[model samples]
Target: MRRGMLSIVLGLALAATACGGSGGAQQGGALQGQRITVAAVWTGAEQDNFKKVLQAFEEKTGAKAEFLATGDNVSTFIGTKIQGGQAPDVVMVPQVGVLQQFARNGWLVPLSADVAKEVDANYAKVWKDLGTVDGKFYGLYFKVANKSTIWYNTQAFQNAGVQPPKTWDEFVKVSQQLADAGTAPMSIGAADGWVLTDWFENVYLSQAGPQKYDQLAKHEIKWTDPSVTKALQTLAELWSKPNFMPGGPQTALQVEFPDSVSQVFSDEPKAAMVYEGDFVAGNIATTGKKVGQDANFFPFPAAPGGSQAPLVSAGDAAVVLKAGKNQQAAQEFVKFLATPDAAKVWATAGGFLSPNKKLDASAYPDDVTRQIAKQLIDAGDAVRFDMSDQAPAAFGGTKGAGEWKILQDFLGNLSDVQGAVQTTAQRLEQEATKAYGS
Candidate 1:
């Protein structure tokens, strides 16, 4: 089956998440004396921030929401729990592939009438459409990240006398100008395959347009298709220039994601920019540069040939399990997750973005984050989910494998030669065939 779009499962589904209670009356008494268990991979500050959202749910509904850490293997945790008859009542799944699997297996419960209604009104059509799978709604996006923003060092831009560009050709020119001014233009974290995938996704989305983006994501079109080849060649415009990067491609292969962000935002920055999602701010937090002042960003430029550059984004979605003991309570918890009240809990504390359109701009801690969050809501139908995340897990989600590994190799082999780029695309198609088949 084709996957659901980035999804609205948008309104509150489980008001407080799911109560671990043994029984429940209706949505009214769903939370009374119940403890709902929600599983996700968030830890450290991300985890602490969400607890506040859960607490808000608790305040409104008399239910206890429990956090279940699934580490990076949420699928494994859910599978194990299902076998043992101890599966979590609610899951905030980051992988769309896993959600599709659960839905296909009938393990998921559709959103109740009230929950669906709230979602319909609170979210845009794009979110509403993605929420429904084969005509039944299942997942509600809780947190969102904009992957189309390119964060640059404010000092780097000022010293180089370059302004943010609006098209790919202009962006390439600006990057060269930054290099000419004696500062490396980019901090390419080729060490993290997902970062490379994001770079590819932004370029591809802008250059190839949505139809081809969706086709490639679904493997409806091969990776070696002309559209993909064109995207790869465009990326080579920057990736192939060794001097444009802090340590060139090979040295970049040694730098991980956090270090990449740190390198650009440091006291004495090594490069002018780093590209990733809004979550890049999390890594920037550990640096000396302030986000809005010392660090600022612009939306990635559009393609040269008049193609649009839309939002490429990702986030966790809340879904309830049919096997959960407190089914109505689980529904209420998810419903609560869709509200501004719940979103504000995390938004104010930092490092969180929501698809809840009703959420206010002031809820965010800073203008940098508020602007980022606004893009997600404002893009409406112009947004696309992270392409790799929409594909099967073996192909899209694993570490050192599939899209991650193939893109990593492609990053290492960056060149202006058309033939080399085509070869990498072929390799990607070959691996994608196997993973999607499996």
Candidate 2:
């Protein structure tokens, strides 16, 4: 089956419908006595925050709230429950990439007209559009975080006598400088394929800009395009640089996101900077360091020929299942989630940036978090979702994973640039063609 561009099933389908919109249904459809269960993909401190919100909801509504928590295998559990006919009433998913799949399979209901209208009026059209597929708004998002930014230790940069780089050339120079200073310039984890994908997507955007890259992923343009090849070539240079990356490209596979983040603050911290989403701040805080005071960020630099880039971001969406047994309760829950109060709760509690444009960001205690929020707002229409999560899993999943492995191998053998890229481009084209036939 050639993966249809519109049918690949990515996007935050669960996140979209989690909140019923303004006109979804006021306060009375069917949830009165029915116990509403919530299934979440978060655990640990994150899970506790969600539990608190659910508890608050239960206390306010007098309904029993049951939670099914799965940290990493959530999608598997969700798939199993749905297939087994024991689907939960509400589910929160992190990206629209996976949610689009669920929605295509009829796993979610579109946001009711009342709810849809309010969402359109209140938030940026892109976010609302992210939740809408086939003209149906099926998801709502409370938080959005920038992903294509670099986090650096301020004092470290001060001591190194270099400013944060704002262009790819400058970034390369800084990497060399840090290497000279015996510091791991980049806390990169290429071992984890997704980390490499992050580097690829940012480079692609910085080189090709969003529209063409979007087109390439959708198969409107070929992967062999000069821009994509250029992007990959640039990434190859970074990965190939001697002592340029921490723990080595192979380390990416072994390093978890937190491990990569903690390295930025380690006493003998392997690296002086990290490139990841705003969410890394949470991972850093877990290591007992503070964001803003102890850390700061700069947008990834622009490619030589690329236009000014948009901020790359990712976040979860609250979705209401189409087959949910309690329509009224689910709808009401959606409404509750859209309120300013809900936005505040999500930001402070979940360590996320709220999607509610009207919320007072000053309420956030973390300066880094607040600055991120302000950056998003100031960038306004320039924010784009994480490219991997925005594209189909084939492009962003296994095949994408395969691309990273090839890069890792090539990083160790820089002399094989053409050979490595030629082989990778062919493989990617074949997979994309199979998944998304021309």
Candidate 3:
């Protein structure tokens, strides 16, 4: 199907139901008067938006859902729940690798037949494949983040007379121009290691393409591969510039992700741009700056000697755990979430992007968000999942994992590119051996 046509069809569907679409209305008969529990890592505003969706489900079907915010370490918390002989009916697994682990451990149950059909019809093959484990469907992808975005302070860009660059060389030149205008060009946020990993992944994917990205994620290629080193060198082009990064690498090592976004939008802004996912929009909103006006974003530019710009993304998948008490009600909720109307609910609430192709782009609350949703759909087969999130937790997801600390150290000293690559390769081998017994 043509990409533009697909987008139009989705937009029409969302527009038609913009006023009175209740996601659970279709399944109210089967789910009435039942209650189920849901567990996920979302909290604060994100949790609130999800709760709105659950409320609609409850209102339509007469079913009740209790939400549990598992914070950042959802796997650890879920494991503890399982060990205690009490688990939530549905869990929002944040990583495909972790979901696969749970499925392999026989802790997850297959989706109900109707929910499976809804997934088959609404999602692209790549999304469905991510939720599948060993030929069985066990999860539903509900929310997505496009990490290949470079958010900028609109006023800063206008004041500096610089436009968003389309290529890496242009990006560096613009950064220099912005610096000359007395604005630090970027916020690094190296304190949180995942942000650093995201930096490396985008450079790698843009430079090495999706095939290499997949191989690296699966550990078929060592971190010391020539492609890996090349990508690191490319990152250093910006990282090594003293005036480009606010407070240099050391300050970045102390800043968390939210603070990083704030740095770009502060009254006296610390930087002109922040490289992160769409979630930054929510953080920007909290600063009382309107998105697309005070702040807006452009796609991360194509790297030198690379393919077209790639979209690096990650999502939360809804999985049914075998230990849950309300299995039937849980299945009903999962099916409801799979519908385009359910996706539209959260999409309209903001700070969410659904992988469900049936959802219309018009359902998004604003142009900035709609643009992001369109970019995700336009990406099609080129969308690559976040590399670190798809790797073993001990190697990538953990706080002090080799991928995190090694990259953090590299950000601290851009001159040690070779040493960083070698150390990362060594640690990855060790961790893979330990985790997989290979």
Q: What are the lDDT scores of the predictions, listed in order?
A: 0.78, 0.68, 0.82
Task: Tell me the tens digit of each residue's lDDT in model 2 across 42-159.
Answer: 7777677777767656654545568877455556777788777777777777767667877888888876655666666667777787787777787887656777679987767877
Per-residue error for 141 in candidate 3, Å, reads 0.4
Better of 1 and 2 by TM-score: 1
Q: Which stretches of candidate 2 lie over 4 Å from their true place?
A: 1-34, 59-64, 70-75, 247-256, 390-395, 399-401
Regions of candidate 3 where Cα sits further than 4 Å from its true position: 1-28, 416-438
Measured against the true structure, the TM-scores of the candidates, in listed sequence, are: 0.91, 0.85, 0.89
- Quote model 1's TM-score: 0.91
Q: Measured by TM-score, how close is model 3 to the native structure?
A: 0.89
Per-residue lDDT of 410 in model 2: 51
Highest TM-score against the true fold, candidate: 1
After superposing all C-alphas onto the true structure, candidate 1 shows an RMSD in angstroms of 5.7
lDDT against true structure, model 1: 0.78
Kindly give the stretch of ten consecutive residues in candidate 1 with the minimal lDDT sum: 1-10
For candidate 2, the per-residue lDDT at 382 reads: 58
Q: 2 or 3: which has the higher TM-score?
A: 3
